[model samples]
Target: MSQIPPPRRRRALGCGIAATAVALVGIVPTAIVFVLASAMDPNYGWLLFITLPIAVFFGSVALVLGVIGIAFALTDRGGYAWPIVGIALGAAQLIPAAALLTG
Candidate 1:
């Protein structure tokens, strides 16, 4: 049997972890929004609740991709920093979204 290359293994692992993190980004914000909406104002809060999940999902993808890209870069592979920057911006948006939904 041919042994797999080390670099390929690292990339695969990094990609998997990054993907999982990206997926989780949606769940966290959505759960937060849902709970807050349910408690404070389930009726109209429902409408405003839409943005949180979408933002989290995309934002998380950016963040995870950034971190993974950085790691890959450090290992000699190149990647753009857009995902990292995107995550930072998205993080800022989360605060306001939470405030609107809860407070």
Candidate 2:
């Protein structure tokens, strides 16, 4: 008799999705604000205050979670697209943060 196949696991997909969402939250709004404000004023240096906390604190979380989630996804045969996106976004957040420090 033929046996049924096991169900595909998605145990870590939620983690991946959450990582992506958090990364987005840390960066997208800040980007939108700068993009909008740059058109009106040449100086918006104070916004670095907002970027610093999110980048230093939450960006690291998203990066670590994304890596862990991707590993879990691979082992569990879950989709990894979100985790990859999350990692990229998390890493991207560091650029502006480093710029803030130096410039």
Q: Output the number of the TM-score-best candidate.
A: 2
**Tens digit of per-residue lDDT, candidate 1, span 10-68:** 55345545654564565566667667788877764665457565865566565666566
- Give the TM-score (vs. native) of candidate 2: 0.77
The 0-to-1 C-alpha lDDT of every candidate, in the order given, reads 0.58, 0.79
Stretches > 4 Å off in candidate 2: 1-6, 99-103
Worst 10 residues of 2 by lDDT: 40-49
Off by over 4 Å in 1: 1-46, 77-80, 97-103
Estimate the overall C-alpha local distance difference test score of candidate 2: 0.79
lDDT of 2 at 23: 86
Separate clash counts for every candidate? 0, 0
TM-score of each: 0.40, 0.77
